[model samples]
Target: MKRISVLAAMACLAACDKSGFNYDNIIDDGGSLQYSLLDSLQVQMRTVQLDSIRTSGTGTGLVGSYADPLFGKFTSSSSFRLGLPSETDPGLKAIYDSVELVLQPDGHYYGDTLPLQRFQVYQLSRPLVLPKDYDAFYSHQQFPVNDQPLADVTQRIRPTSGNKVHLRMNQQFGLELFEKIRSKSDDIKNEEYWRDYFKGLTIRGVDNSAAFRLLMNDTAVVMRIHYHIVKETVEEKTIDFHMNLSELQFNSYSYDRSGTPIAGLTPGADGIMGETTGNRTFIQPLTGAVTRIDFPSIAALKELGRYGRIMQAELVIKPDNGTIKNYPVPPRLTLTLADKKNVVTQGDTISNAAGVQYGNLVTDKLYPENNQYSWDLTEYCRAMMAADEYNYRGLLLAAPFSEFHTQLNRLVVGDGGSKQYRAQLKIYYLLYE
Candidate 1:
């Protein structure tokens, strides 16, 4: 046994002295131990289209449209119901001045905002309602609106300036609303009556506009009806109608991929392979698109030795150069386990011993080659190897749930076989002889 141990140690040192091998620590417990590094494992990647994502009650509303050469066209619209003011009566003698819709930016946006963007507000034909079977609205849900717009405004949006956008509504619509409040009519007296009369409003952007998010808090978005009384030198008063049920507010997202690489991609389907699309995979959370990674040859690692353990595993994801120039990638990404059907396994998020892992991202603007996101997959590999059967399971790379439903962040990464930037998985295994 002593002579065998010495010979094994010599062989381990000889292997480590190779050009691409580094000497890692060793473990000796009456067994011959050797460390080997493998980075040539097969990694398969594809773009998966999620069925639908909940978009209601996210505390943020999206609006506007933008076209991308790689991602095609994306459009978002916000819809919400309005509530009557607490002070139901504006007084019988009050005269109507004007009404305007105020939208407060939450400092989140995608695409360009330098040029003027056009926004239109239309009253929903029916009230916003969630079906009995559904708990919340999804990004694909949309309600019908009137033919004519209640408000149309075009202006340059300043997302970072901490300013409010005041869109003056149609004169007739404002006048009718003001008249009902002044008279204390039933339509303006209670929530039910008000919601029926004024179902809600959907704010949308015209074509070729940049997408932006608006604050959906209690005081961020509202419609102020200006009025005044003829007594005591014309005292001015404003009655604000805020969003009635903020929980019901939702943003509807639509996309057009007719001329894009993923035009034929179908939701809940087998997904498009990376090699078929120029060795690239896509992830755009707003549209429920995620990147799927599979390791078909992972089992081959077990053939290296009779008894082995994975000491460390690392996954590095590299986005294609020049894809993030104007369109920024998601700030953080999560990896979740999904079956072959692309259904995510609940509570199966990938993590290390510490906690859930968000890829520790490193950006390199000057040296774009260094831009990458990496994660420790030591435990995940161990579990995958210990499974009873080859479950046809894979990892779905996506943005966090909070940002996934509310933001338009996206990323495009290269597969393992890419020429410029490729996703890589490196594993350090300890072999016992």
Candidate 2:
């Protein structure tokens, strides 16, 4: 009897229409689905321009040059003052053997080692005296040099191989300097006097084929004068001249971005729109070419209605593959807030703990499929929401430690458009209403 009743009930239920079993007919409790109640979010992308970064005395022990087919050429040179070790001189009977400049490698370069280059040392015509305390030196400074070089070499060099380079100097010039020291001339008495006689020295790259880096600290770089004092016995002695740590020393750089996409745009000014700039932009340490970005519509997020709080904010940048051939990717990129005057301000929350900081770009990783980087802008967005007076006018992107270098690594990024690769913003928030 029970089996017959169960079959009769199943037959009746199956006979009902599909609407009788619809889940949508149940009463809905709305708390779990409250996400749908929040106001819609908004994202906007703005065009940027290229600004020129100030390149001056960077204290890093790096100097080199590399030619890029797209960006043209880059060159680096080191300039500093060399002075006598002491005021008192050894007695004059010593015969001068020779003078040589010794430079130790810093183990860094950006080109192939097959090509040979010419490294030449020139004597500055004027003392390297700075007018102010914090005076800056640029690559374009025009300091004259002697017609003759103290030392010159044309050979293939691998400075990153843990070796030192010794370029022999002219014996005649070495003897002349030795005589002045033996005579205890006024020129050899004090720092000022010595500087007046020998202004300074500049180690430069003359050949466009290759570039090299040298450690120029007081210990690694030296000018040695080999001589022997003759008395009853032959005692070989040597005098050393070294670079002054107190004086200004720096690498001067020059870049020729003639035929590249960067050539179509003006630099040292505001960033041009991506649409106006061919939907792409550039940043290179060698040229101090900085990319500037702005989001004019970000402030409108507050007007969208009340929200509990923002959980996070991110700015996404997509790299353009068109510029990736035949060049090493940039080691890193730095983003910072610019002031009202469009100058880089001091509010970047860049830290070591988090690889993706407030304004630091990812360097160690690159996603080939996406080829993108995301920056956390939670603090910046919060400040904007709080209506605090901020120095953050926009964002500027470039490489760090680039004040005195020609980092061959350059970057090209996409401007926002209907395309999927366009730059965009992502914000996650909660709602209380």
Candidate 3:
């Protein structure tokens, strides 16, 4: 009998008006059916520290350092091996002019770029190889480098201007490279020999430097050795070594959260409640920090009535005003299922009838009150309401994995107990006798 009544209620919902209806509106329909809207559900928010995520083969180079008042100091460095040039010989009459490392910006940056930033390039002590038991390099991985730097440069970076960053390399280094190709040594004859002779390089930014994204395509980042042929007109020639295999490149990131609201947060530990962290939660995937949301009062809905169904559920999240001035918010955000231990379940992302929800973001710079990220949580709420046992699973709000590994975008949102703009959950319920 209960199954038949549930099927009948579903049929009625399908036949009802599909356009839209006001909340709590009682449609007579000459039947004993009613609807109610509940928006006072208690929400719990927290900041969880995730384990190191894979950062290799992203095809983007990240280098620099920046200090954040809320997130502490963040630093990134890129490392990769260069391929052998097609034409190893620069001719016997070639006279070494100079060499420079060129980096093309990809128009992505964080923090202030007006100040002079310092960058240094170091030769790797060993070859670029994964660890014994590791399959891929993670954001926290690091490689040993030579003490002496090959190139050191300082300049104001303009990432979006389409200008490339050129750093003059050491003359001794360039001369030795030219000599190897000129003499036609075994080191310059093949890729493996060349890789062994010239292991790799690591580029890093000094402390307090702003982070910027650089193109890591086969031809984008290159080392060019310029030379002049002793011809009648002094003709010039160049040999280029590029970052050939995109999968060989990676970026390493580190962060210090000392003295911050989320201090002492670590992976595998229960997350810190937003109320204890100044009533706010943070989402910065680059550093493995994501926002956790829980519907603590969802089970209480059963007390309202025995035959009640959730017709719709909506979650609205608001960022604290004045939090995104220099640091831009991520364009899209998604939710994934997480266990009570704060471990995110793999391949359990949440989605609605329309597919994966990206939190339709509404930006309002003029009036911050209009800024919010809205998501449809109807299906998830229905499952929670129908569960016989109490559900301890929660959602982890974060950027997509692709963007999370490549970009350092961040967001600070108000929790349910925030004094200012707080997160809200609204559900439309239908009751039948």
Candidate 4:
């Protein structure tokens, strides 16, 4: 009896639908007025092409969920091929220099109806010195002791039997070395001679007198300065894959010191390196569109010098009024560094092996609520360090199914004609001596 009643009810409903509504009319309207699938319902949509974008800050912004602070979280698929004379063959180097993603609109535009709504830039100020090792910074600066044995009075010039001489910066600059040195002084620029002499000797000094020094292998120092291309600003022949969106527009944004409008920069395959060590936190002051507060993770804070805590982030956006008709937001993409340990030690030659460990990262403002990272970062860092392989995977950072660099590739999807959003991507940098 229940089954018969249920069948009768279904029939009645079906009959009522046919009698009261016309499915044909709805289709004619080009909208699902009466009924349709999700895809068919959005007909008034304006399309921004899949080919229009490439890049986000997180290596995973291409597929992850993030509201990019900078429009950098998004960029057009513009191709750039730079000319580098230093490279002999330029195979990998050539490829690195020839990749970029161009952003395209459904229609070409000009003048009052510019296809792109917002174009901005950001400038970050960083300190010149780097902090790579522990005990690197001090209240009073000091130099390293020379690692090589001193000149050999006996075959090998070993400094004074057991006493190894530590060369400080002041020692070479002192009156003793500068006043008495007689070699190569005739008709030579005295300043040039002095500078060369200091470079040759591992002179040591202690602080005003404060010029400190540490004696290290010149070969090691030279090795540290090597410049291998890390990230190339690029536009590739093809993209990995892409998604389609009806429309996108920019609303309000956190404006910091986005540098001069990004227009000043030529988009090309320029291998840029990470400006600082990976994931250090600092407070960045803002002017125009850049906004915020910052407190970087302990590991990142330590890795980046104090200046890094206050850093600049660029959000490249083409802002539009709330309801612009067809402006498109470029898709955010990312290139993640394969994480490993102890592989990269030089500015040049960024190997996939040298990417920083995922476990070592800690961002204070990764989430939108603007929550703070642990204040006692040393303790928090220690706790993170204590995790074993078994428990650490998901607890510290999110776990991945197959790929290791989920952080780099994650990006936010736009919806409800949302105006403000972001996708982030990273570039590595090097300081060559």
Candidate 5:
């Protein structure tokens, strides 16, 4: 937020205006704010901080927020009505505002040059369960359709009753779904050319139930649907794992591939990394609002079982917008020094510098075809936060959050000037015993 003295400094800096207050001939967009010699004087400006953070809980964690300011000034009896709905919590507040002097010569049309008030408002709701009162919430509700502008190819899902275990997969991701069926035998084992299978491919009825079943071919081969999303919402659902295969072992892991656009894994590293090795992992979150936001959030996931033995799983969904309110995050985010040297001169270039370094800092997407993002090394980016003064270990995961976006803030500004500046935010979580 700009302080009072800063506002004065701004006015003085622009005092270089000739016709009126040209202050270096201000022109951010295509046009400029100028003055003529025959107009009176006036100024309007404001600065504000959101009052308090709003919070809600789910399982054992919470999420919260920041502030947004509102201000304006006009010559007449101004009457501007605001339309912000305060459905929940204390009404919003106007942090600061003021109107003042522009005394100057006549014929010199003049006006104020104050940075407008702007902030992101948020409401953290109680963290919800996967199948809790789901029916009551979305029973009659219909999701507003914004059809996929581009449809992805459907993976050819083959199901052979015996031979291997198969799992169904989401079509948006174009990876081949492999079913590990009965390994090998004497008779027709030589025909293992992409183990052929049968699948009931109809787009109606108890979709998954009719499809995600175990089947075997005469040659003793099996197929499985890796995973499936049957119900849009459920009051009670379970993920039945083949207790025999699972070792009943659940591991904590973080998304560390070079392609994800998370907060802490850019050209450096942060807390989310699992020991620079593959074993350490972080649990993916699934919350109600977030479930409704992302395609594969926890609430939207359902793992079918053998004899209906549901595997235990928990999910927390977060808002798609990049902020760490209810989620445990540092009061403020301070990024590690970006390499700056590996800057890209073009987008499609696949040179050594183009692979990982440039992807995280310059683009939200890395593996665009698969909708994969880039990650920022949270600890390195926020090395300053680890000091004794900050003390953010278990309380905060200390990783960066990412979102898929098309407009690259880099291209819009280039070397000419910076246009819109945004940061890779933090994603926090705690996997309990």
Candidate 6:
């Protein structure tokens, strides 16, 4: 039994020797640990301003104005060309009676809705001409309108509650259109000539103190002319003009962020050049604003005595709950890498069928529980360490579907302060010899 005990002790020592540790080292010190935390390392944070994004008209919406006390005021206008009806022949002596314009909602809106909002519809003074390959349109593009409005409407509408806006139009103008179509003039018969004759229509918020959203798709904007024909018995018929693919269309949005928390922000500043004196960062949709992040200290990780493989890396951004109040937060937010010149370029590691970088924002329940956004950037950080490529350029944060949609949501992030709700980057790694 004593010899068996001695052999068992020898075997235990051999096992420890194979494992690169002795009993003393194993009990008192971690001799064969695969990883160790670089205790002296922490990321540095800085803020930069993002440039204005293109507000190209996509999806199905022509949004309008609304005001927010915290985020400031937002206004939008829609311009679209009209197409004539297929059935032009309503028999002889077609007496045009009335005309109406109908607009539908896409069930999305922001800000106060209790106050009455006014909208005006005007005819464009010139035709909306565009090249066949025009990819995008900015909010700054201008199309002058006639002095007289075709229609005006004022009402309290809750688009979120499945309501729409209806406006009575000018009957005299409707009658003129009917006459021109009946006569089959070149201006009325040819599509290009029709657009030249009618130009386009613009729907804008006139004297609105509140803001709302509407889905202005092919079927959203409709002009119907009710007329009666003296054929045997007075038969009533309606001719409709639709804003569809027959012509070019676009949406324009403007923001008056004055007298708000971010009022002093320079309009077009990009990156650290646009940093404000305050210790807070702001983000707004509708090409309003974006948050830029930079990490100079991340490059220093290599200076540590060891090299490591990044097992997990996360960027956690905490939002100021008080700033958002009861406003609806954006459903998703995006993180984009910057170029070598520190410019946030348009290339994503992932691209869609059209080759356009598919910018996917992290959309999940991480925001509501802790009022924060936690992004899993492990692969990104790993690539950064491996190639040392864009680790210095940091990232850009913006909302999804905001390039073309009129979303009024905004977020406030704590920065460079003693506040508990600040943005941070956390990483867990395994060290190597």
Worst 10 residues of 6 by lDDT: 1-10
Tally clashes: model 6.
3
- Candidates' TM-scores? 0.89, 0.77, 0.89, 0.15, 0.16, 0.79
Residue lDDT tens for model 2, 1-433: 0112223323433444233322323333564212222112233323333334333344433345667765667777777877687634767566878898888877556666678777788888877765465466655554678999987877667766787878788788888888888888888888888889989887787744656666666777788888887889989887888877533676667677677656554443444556655676666655656666666555655532232245566777777767677555554566676654456655534333332243334543455637666777766776565443463356676665542253446777776652645776665543222
lDDT tens digits by residue: candidate 5, 222-249: 1112232235642221112111111111
**Local distance difference test scores for all models:** 0.81, 0.61, 0.81, 0.20, 0.18, 0.61
Candidate 4 regions off by >4 Å? 1-75, 78-355, 359-433
What is the per-residue lDDT of model 6 for residues 149-239, given as tens digits with 9 covering 90 to 100?
9988777777777766787788788778777777777877768878889888888887576555566566777888889978689888888
| TM-score of candidate 5 against the unseen true structure | 0.16
Superposition TM-score, candidate 6 onto the true structure: 0.79
Q: Between 4 and 5, whose TM-score is larger? A: 5
Pick the winner on TM-score between candidates 1 and 4.
1
Report the lDDT tens digits of candidate 4 across residue range 182-265.
222321234344223322211111111011111122111110001123355443321111111111111111112133122122
Worst 10 residues of 1 by lDDT: 1-10
Q: After superposition, how far is residue 161 of candidate 5 from its true place, in Å?
A: 34
Give residue 371's error in model 4 in angstroms. 4.0
Error of 3 at 299 (Å): 2.0
Candidates 4 and 6 compared: the better one by lDDT is 6
Candidate 3 is scored at a TM of 0.89
Question: Which of candidates 4 and 5 reaches a greater lDDT?
Answer: 4
User: What lDDT, from 0 to 1, does candidate 3 have?
Assistant: 0.81
- Model 4: per-residue Cα lDDT at residue 348: 13
Q: Give the 10-residue window scoring lowest on summed lDDT in candidate 3.
A: 1-10
